[model samples]
Target chain A: MEIEDENNFKLRPMKCELNYLSRSDGSAILAQGETVVLVSVNGPLDIKSTSQSIEKATLEVLFCTKGGKPSVADRFKENIIRQTCETAILGCLYPRTGISLTIQELEDFGGLLTCTVNCACLALLNSGIAMRHMVAAVCCAVSEEGNLVLEPSYTQVQSASALLYFVFDSRERNLVTGFTEGSFSENTYEEALARCRLASDVVFDFYRDIVKQYSDVI
Target chain B: MKISIGDVVLPGDYCEEISQVAEKSKVIIGPGLRKEVDRVYITKPGVLKKRNPGTFWVDSYQKRYVPSRGENVIGVVVQKAGDIFRVEIGGSITAALSYLSFEGATKKNRPEVQVGDVVYAKMLVASKDMEPELVCVDSHGKKGRLGVLSDGFVFKCSLNLIRKILNPNCPLLETLKNEWPFEVAAGMNGRIWIKANSMRETIAVGNAILGAEYLNDEEIRSMCNNIAAILAGHVS
Candidate 1:
């Protein structure tokens, strides 16, 4: 009776706290509908004085998904995150020095991985790690019928004709990173990028809010 | 727009930044732009400038080519012929590694080199008209460092990056010097072979160590951990 009542009530999955780690240099756990991600940032660690350069600090990014194994999908996500972080961190300043950031995704309930990267980047910035820009990410899936869907679920992605992931410096709206159409042609790529740019606007706005909330917490 | 490696006083078709001109020495060869006698010189493209001491890069995009005698290279076994193995070491036509070269194999029963095996050898001889010949012998004509590398991961990379990696004090080399847990041999040909217990860990470490030349250690380590974490499917 209780289960039937819950179903009949149309209750949705619960959302909870993000960035479960308090002392981590920086951390965040994002819940988007059923999808979830936990991210953390650490370092700006000292490079050996002899090895240190007067340039920019280094930048690093990592990604993980719910499955026990990090599939090709996860590797693709990691690279996109890395590119965005590189644009934001300004690595040329630290010359001989080093800096790194790591992100982990605990679950993938839907098309929320890109949002997770955005949240992780925001968390890194919030932690006061030096960065030149604020980065965010968004995804768009084009259906077989040529309809564009912003942030489609895993099932939708499987059914879609193409998928595009874009990472952006939200404040400036610059295209900081992009990866798409595992098997797409040049023409398809151009269309996906345009669609992704439109989808990125919404994700970037979300990043702005996350930053504001994070700064307020600090 | 035209470009060159470091700074462009004169622009042409090229990618990447020009770092600095190299000193002229007998080791410098090949063309585009090279540092010679402490000055930059642009040699005709697709031409082989005499080997000088100065560091140089191929201005064009081409796979590694077979080396002449006295040239060192790293290669991977990609195919097998009755008694010979097809080896690729950043070159166009895969070099031939004959079964008779390695000391123990006889004609009737030859040594087998499977796909994915890494070997560090020298180009003892090559002629434009024939398949390049690979020799596993040392300068003294000994077979001390010659053998089939059974366990390792091979990867393809840019030729320029490969050149940067071979020089002394190079970032990837330095990282490996700092107590690397695996055995790695980076050939001048852009083929990097890494052997370790954990393939995933080895790859993570390899990328970070190699990336160090272009990125800082902190960044590299972060990348390593990031890759490791992702492979482990763990959340930070």
Candidate 2:
């Protein structure tokens, strides 16, 4: 089957560049709307004996803000990203090794979590680390007008009543992560979940495009 | 998605062709493709490739090396234990190189191997839970093209580039073979050791290999031609 392009996508346009770093094993810079993130993946490299796991490779994730010292919120984001990626990476393939993922936030207009998760997934793909499946993250906001805005901008998020971020794996489209802020009705939450799930397909298509472009060039 | 050969596949995509062949005969599934209970799944983002009767794998670009048994690799000896040497092959851990595994080495006789010396050896035992072991001699006790590589420069590159130059279809090695009198050893771990009459010829070989990393077949041919011409004093 022919791979579908993202022209039919209603979410904000995405731009990405893969394998840009000279030192990192794999790196990618992804910009979703105004939110830009740079991510790099290295390993299964030699692991320290202290942190080695006999059953599987240890995953270490570091989240960096644009500048200054990391705050509690950054640590929280790191946990979320680490959990989401750990689920996807087949860490058992390289037992006693460590896979390190470093993410630097460049621009955070809105939907920071969604953009970060998506960019992290792209970096993992570029690293060629075996993963059970790929993941796509979508952000939606419930505006004061009682309408859901997909991939809300800074101003859109400020005026919105609630914001939701959902990460879905490619296989089965299962929800791997979900984060929300403010209050919304149960019915509205379900509606946002469905819409985010559909929007995730656009991100997956974007990933396919990036991989296909690089593979063809090589 | 029902993936066919040559299709750009993603992790978790299904390939029915392999399952159909499995019912009749055995198939070799390489890296990037995993066999589940009932079907075949791609675990990488790249083109699904097939060879011969039934060998399928996804050719994804990667840098990190995972030691696999029977693959020849170049490593640097890091530590010297009583009976074995710890060689760092860019894997998860240092591989053990037993002294007795060398050619013509007995308990009383030891090969003059030193720390930080580069060697081309074959992986004898590479298991997930066990330490990887390297051997300098073949089963026949011959050290043919697999031993201490001295007086040569070594450089690291992506695993994909190593595979590219080593492939029979790739013109990289074929083009360089005619350029100059040089000896080269490429390890699957992405280290390449090269030696020639002088530094100029050695650098030329290294240049040709590194330059071919991103170039297509046509471009690589011209690049090799240019390097060869420059080295022969035909062009300055």
Candidate 3:
């Protein structure tokens, strides 16, 4: 299960564009390989008395698939995204309000959940929403040969033995959320976590570059 | 990129100049600039703008409309509840427009307003705790360009674009006004109501305004001329 070669792990080509939608407060379209996700955020808006919390803003996440209705799996994805984003956002700053995030899946090659999380984070940043710290997620798969593959494509995903998604916060690189799909040995899981955490640096650097590119426009 | 004035700033970034000015006198920090115990920090991702001596604010390209007092907004009449009309100004909550807020209206006579109509009104009271209030008449009881808009096309754009086109220095309106006869009412809420002699002209005006959002002053002028020439059948 020990693959010491660094070349074994590589992320797919990533692209992101902010403010993709005119109606949403903040929006972004993110693509990794063939997987594309569009995310829009609207909030710090008025909340109904029943849903409004006096102490913090209410967070809602919705996931929509391509030309299909949302299913139970989509609901689970939305729940994971909402919980991860809630930890990053400074919800207390917008008390008695609501922050709604809607994610639309345009394409799903592989690692769809990871791409969704990353896209949502960028959309949140574009919205100018206050946050305690930024979050970045990376997905890794363990192939049949025990090779760790970062951001495996659709075909690779089908052949992989196990898959893991890890989300890290910017403050201390702490784990915000982690999801696993298949069983793996303890040593293999630890190795995959370490590799994915290292690969997350690439995502974080990508975020900074995107922000800096837009910051120059003004 | 430049890290100076007119550059995009993010939350938690501090400005030494603002902090220094705060020491000399009481400075009014507008939206996007927050004053903590130590320094002045930016709370939005946009260009930092300064006016004259002490007024500072961020010129961010935002789509959401946050209601503020004394600002004119174009809203739709969504609900006609008994005495108050709930107007959707793209804010968190619908604003209340009382029928009596219209000019020459009394208990016996109610303003002829219906749902789905667009109204150009002024925000009388916009607070965080309560719903906003709108009025179609001025203090002198005059409907001075503030009333229900009729037979015009309404569309929404980014809030910053509305402000950009409305700015006196902007050449978009100046150049377009000469090409054709058109009337435009731009609301601070990112909604614009435009009307022209023909539907083609109206669409042309709309396209020009929307296209001018990303262009500079010189580019905007040229774009206006291009649009005008096309509308005049100079280009196919």
Candidate 4:
């Protein structure tokens, strides 16, 4: 699946960053082009729980705007990120206590969900919240002329009929989370998935570059 | 044979006296009955020995005071022992203000003074006792700028910047001439007190004060919002 320029839609600028704060265990700011989101992770810290503290860690998520109000779309995005992050995080080691994560978006040009999840992954690493592997997200827009575009921007996404966001953990090349079309045929969905896997490689490479740049400072 | 304060004598200047009048020299060199002493001694050639004498001078590391018959000095009240309050005049030694010194104060009020309050007063007397003593009074039987500033915000910055801001022709200074109504007390020690202004105006002045150091126009634009935000108290 290819998202073409003739469709008047293009790939969004993937503006992402990691380990942006020192006070938190993990923190990152991901700006998917114009969409800027700040994500922070607070540890598997000590929590008073009776008896059942030995088995699995808990996950807690909070979402808010600059003024602390949760919009409907923000709530939807928060739930998606929470579910996706829970899948990627190592939930067994931190028993009894729930690790908390907060996502705040200052500016949203487009592709907010993808950027929020990507930033959450980096924030988990920054918080030193243990994770099975690093993960990344990219939104792909399928153009009318049968071209698959990776990381579609706000304008491109609006112009396109269908937009799909793929969240993947690079270690196992596993799909941790996914969002896509309902009306398209199975063939097109499969093609978009294939393109998504390829698009994920680009995000993974970007993730590795970020880690390499910040490894020395860490 | 007698030494006084601010006396200039040479190094080995007392050497001859050390032999002939050892007692008097001992009084000068050793701790004597004097409450305090200030002497400038330079090294000179010894009479019996052959040695070269070089000429070099250095001021003492101890505190130096500059007071005319009437010059105002600001001091911070640091201690209260018995009837006296010890005021630190930006130096190692403190000046004492006795209860009697507050003559103008009525008994009902009793001129309440406390530690950490900055007081401005004229030095009626500066003499050595156990330490330097200062009386807060004027000869015409009147109180001058001899009161305590007990409440306000205090911050420290370079003294040079303060002087620059106080300069009337300074562009940054001109911009803030009456923009913010604030009484600023700039100290030689770099402590500045900016009191009672709208938070917005105070921050604007602070930013403009900082802008004096940065001469670039474009560079300042990037910081303009931040400066405004700081004045707005949006950014802590």
lDDT of 3 by residue, B1-236 (tens): 11456666654456777777778887788877777777676666667888768888876657778788999999999999999999999987789999999999898999899999999999999876668999999999999999999998999988878988999999999999999999999999999999899999999999999998878999998999999999999999
Candidate with top TM-score is 2
Clash count, one per candidate: 28, 0, 0, 14
What is the TM-score of each predicted model, taking all chains together? 0.41, 0.97, 0.80, 0.44
For A66-180, candidate 4 gives per-residue lDDT tens digits of: 6777678677777888888877665664455567788887887767778788788767654544355566787767666655666766676777767788887755567888887
Q: Name the Cα RMSD for model 2.
A: 3.3
In model 1 chain B, the worst 10-residue window by lDDT is B7-16
lDDT of 1: 0.56
Can you write out model 2's per-residue Cα lDDT over A54-129, one digit (the tens) per residue? 8988999999898858899988999999999989998888889999999999998988888888888988899889
Docking quality band of candidate 3, CAPRI definitions: acceptable
Candidate 4 lDDT, tens digit per residue, B1-236? 12223333211122232233333333333211111123322221111121113112211111123222344556678998877888876433566777556647554546688778776665655432234455556655466545565565555443334544555555554344434356655544334555555665655655555565435334444455456566556678
Tens digits of per-residue lDDT for model 3 on A1-218?
Answer: 55666545468999999989877899999999999999999987887789998787899998999977869999899899999999878787676789999999999999899999999989988887766567889998889998788889899899999999999986467789998988889888888788888788788778768877876542
Candidate order by TM-score, decreasing, is 2, 3, 4, 1
lDDT of 2 by residue, B1-236 (tens): 57799989999799999999888988999989998888899999899999978899999988888899999999999999999999999987899999998899999999999999999999999998899999999999999989999998999998998999999999988988887788999999989999999999988999899989999999999999999889889999
Off by over 4 Å in 4: A1-17, A47-54, A66-68, A144-147, B1-236
| Colliding pairs, model 2 | none
Q: What shift in Å separates residue B92 of candidate 1 from its native position after superposition? A: 46
